[model samples]
Target chain A: MTVVDIPPPLPVRDRTALHERAPGALSPMLTRLAEERATGVLVREHGTLHLAEGRVVHAESPLAPGLDVLLTARGTLDAAAWPWTDDIPAATHRLLVAGLLPRGALELCRLGALYDAGYFALAPSSTPGRFRYGTTAAAGPPGAVRPLRAVPVTALERETLRRRELLHRIWPDPSADGAPLIRADPVAPPPVTPRQRAVLDRVDGVRTAPQIARELGRPAFHTLVDVRRLAAAGLLVPRNTVPPPPPLPPVTDPDIALLKRLRDALEAL
Target chain B: MPGIDECLLEAMRLPGARGAALVDWTSGLALGTVGEAPGGDHETTAAEAAELARLAAEHGAFSTADDTEVTPPVEDLIVSNRDSYHLLRFVVTSFDATVFLHLWLAREDGNLALARIRLGEMAERLVLG
Candidate 1:
């Protein structure tokens, strides 16, 4: 992903001006820009909100999580779900016009994901209550447009959204990508719960199940069983590209204190 | 034939059953709690239970090698201790949120197979808001 700084307090333009001038409209409007074809970032404005798209794909928006990152996080949607189809901008426009999802919701998904993926803060939507388009410019990746045409489109999208929300529940740290892999200080005492203890027995981190068993002096099958139990308890973090975690809320209530205590006790073992 | 409350009540009815609760996983909020927790802190236990669900959901999302993509949305999570077992079963759906039943039972008294079957039956009748 490319990053371009927006000049301080970008002069806001009207929706029609954006629709006619933004890259979102440029392809259709391309026949008209008789000079040099622009190949940078286009930030479209609708009221105060902006939706950004590169020539090949959308980078960020106030509404949607980055589809690629969201899909990666869900793990349910393989990379295949986000195959590169020509004309991503048009496809996005079509998805919006088709009313499959509200434009803002889509933007939230992308924006939320981008935020989790380590991007800039999303500005609140400033688009007028009336539907219209606008434009802005940012640094962008070089590539032709690519649209998403993955299978179980609805399923993929929903799963990714669910995963995104789940990640937000933990910390903002992107390290835990839903893997069964977890890291615990070996020197720490085992947790009180047998389930947690079982998890610790399997944490070699570098090896798969069979290898973990050899190191721990356990049967491969038994090790797998224990590993599955720990995984179910959410004690393991898988290795690989992790999805953005759900946003964790500040622990405010007194009950949260006690709960954290129990959690710590359990995981410590 | 059981309602949401009925489900929890039924889970507690099992031999050696200790306590039960209904949790909404989306927000990790326990909708209701029944029976006494070891510390007699239902509120805290419920909150913790939600955290467990959150963790499980996160692990599921990032573990790409697992068959989660093929496995139907998780219907249940069961954790066993030396003396007891804790079961958290998700009520399956495609809506914006999810609900689950959390049950605690004495290991010596609990029948895992039976409990699973009953939980599955209970999940189908749950009325999610």
Candidate 2:
């Protein structure tokens, strides 16, 4: 009896090859199909084209409005757009065969994420058959597009650091407090008012009025008065805890019983 | 190809360059900024650019046929004035962040093609890691 040997996967090789491709050159990412055949997905910064069983599976480009941010921003697609949704893979296969999504609008980032997630999910991990690529795609439930970057996993931590740096450039305060580590200085009081200026200067993130008064060797109550006055003048902001959510009463609609009866009858029918 | 930072500088080197900034799409924050001192604060500019990106992205998703499954990922945004043009180029790197480079240029002195080419190169060089 003759034995048929199955071929190993191609994503690992394809990833290395794609990484080695010249910066400006077109890159093709090869992956193995369930039938043990070679397949590929050509990837670029702005576009992607997928091939299966020696045929084009899909093609996408970002000439105008890109597609990734579109679907997610509108909250239209979730991972359903992944490479192996039940109806989608087949739909895309047919579309590719028929030339529908050729140079089609692909939210490139989403495409990238789907490809990465699908490729990693199927390529000989603990879980198998969960989300197989090269299969029919199905419509997924509504969800948001998770973030996907081009950097490899090895560099993810460093990438996160840099991403945070970039994020801070815009919103210096990522927290709910919306305040920087170093609080803003109070507005300058008139030169004659040393008392107000002293109060303003002591109102840093660190010490409270009591602490400041203790350090200055002054009476706590007098310092508290000054602090309160400055705070009232809109020159200072003290930390405050977030308020709790209000309570809700139980529902007591008079039509509830009637609705329940109607529902029970519909179920019985 | 230079990284996103270098790309903004190259953009600023353009003949009537005004200012530039890079923004994150998710939060609408500027990653970096250049040029426009008198225009406004960087935070304000970044916030405004983010708003534009959000509007454009929403519009694209609404207009798409796959509204059920498709959303527009913004690649670039452009605005023109009597004397200048503002360009926003988005780069979706592997880390799941959407970053955009904002460039402002004088229409009369700027070369659109060169600016675009430079931006593309910069996007490729941007080291998300």
Candidate 3:
């Protein structure tokens, strides 16, 4: 009998992730901000993150739903009772005085939305991210509700990495993350959980995962999970690799055609 | 469910309660925390607990008929050791709330049955935006 030793391809655990993939290493600007204790907004092409004293106060992205959508979807915020703007602090104070909303609940919602969108905001990008110090009117009406305790930038980055790792484990293909989903023609479709079925029902071949998440008021990452699983089950049109564009029609060079015809005519002459 | 802080504070009032937190299982993010953490770190404890919660919530073996679109399949889970116990109860809300209340209590002094009952009530009343 021979004893053979084999090594795993890659250790996909969180601990290994910490050492192998440095948190926020992809975005050096955020680390620099934390060192300076800078208070301002970090803007990228895809999204923006608000920071106060180097901690993440708020974050928003076009790719993920905002706090208002999540709040409305949960049916907790009464627009009349709690009219809110960017100033989370101010809006929260008003709601507290009105005795309509709990500060803790609002904070938690903001936190969830913060991380949800923050994940997209901190994604690796082609362009350099810009940072502006000092609060702007856009930061919130001077009294916008900020999270009671700001989350460390590093922590948010770490969590974002963890989410990406989890999604990759579920399905390695990255196409479904952005592609408009269409059902696959499986001989027999696999069954999905009630929650996943809801996700599948919204597969209109026009809406991507993020759009579906906004419509459903679910966290975008969860929606991605369902999409990946659905893809693995042959429920979604699996684009294993990015499909190449169709070939262009042959160009008609009239001069060459006329030249060849002229040469033939001369030879006949 | 009760707002994050309030629910955690309520759990702390229970006998032998050491620490409590409201965590989102899917994202493994701790919404809020109170008292002392089992591992002396709230964030790490929440993430670790979320792992167990996700397992119970997603697996087919522990799934019950009571499971519905909005309701989580497993009501709660209990893990006990020599000197402590961890109680996790899933919360149901209008939206797909993938959150649970985690309570770490002293083994000898904690009332397991009472904590479980109260944790369930807290989870039921928990309100999230």
Winning candidate number (lDDT):
3
Instruction: Mark the regions of model 3 whose C-alpha exceeds 4 Å error after superposition.
Output: A1-24, A78-97, A136-147, A185-190, A238-269, B1-3, B34-44, B59-67, B124-129
Task: Point out the worst 10-residue segment of candidate 3 chain B by lDDT.
Answer: B120-129
* C-alpha DockQ of every model: 0.02, 0.03, 0.24
For each candidate, C-alpha RMSD in Å?
21.2, 23.9, 11.9
> What does the lDDT come to for candidate 3?
0.78
Instruction: Report every candidate's CA lDDT.
Output: 0.47, 0.45, 0.78
lDDT of 2 by residue, B1-129 (tens): 233445567668866678887665444445456778326777667767776875665454434454421223445677887877887776644322345777777798887778877766566555321
Per-residue CA lDDT of model 2 for A1-269, tens digit only, reads 98988888664545555546532122122222212443444444434434444333333433211233333333333435533432433443342333222211222333433332222122222322221244311212212321111222212222223334443453343331112111344567422123445556766666665455444433232244345445444455555445457787654776986798799999999
lDDT by residue for model 3 over A116-232, one digit each (tens)? Answer: 888889777889999989762323343434325568888888888878887888898878988889888789886677778888899877889999899888878778888998999
Q: Candidate 2: where is the Cα deviation over 4 Å?
A: A1-269, B1-4, B61-72
Which segments of candidate 1 are over 4 A away from where they belong?
A: A1-269, B61-72
The candidate scoring highest on TM-score is 3
Q: What tens-digit string does per-residue lDDT give for candidate 3 at B1-129? A: 245777789889999999999999887888888999987989889878998998888776787766666666788999999999999998776544588899999999999999999998877656532
Using DockQ, rank the candidates from best to worst: 3, 2, 1
RMSD of 2: 23.9
Give, for candidate 1 chain B, the lowest lDDT window spanning 10 residues. B62-71
DockQ, computed on Cα atoms, for candidate 3: 0.24
DockQ of 2: 0.03
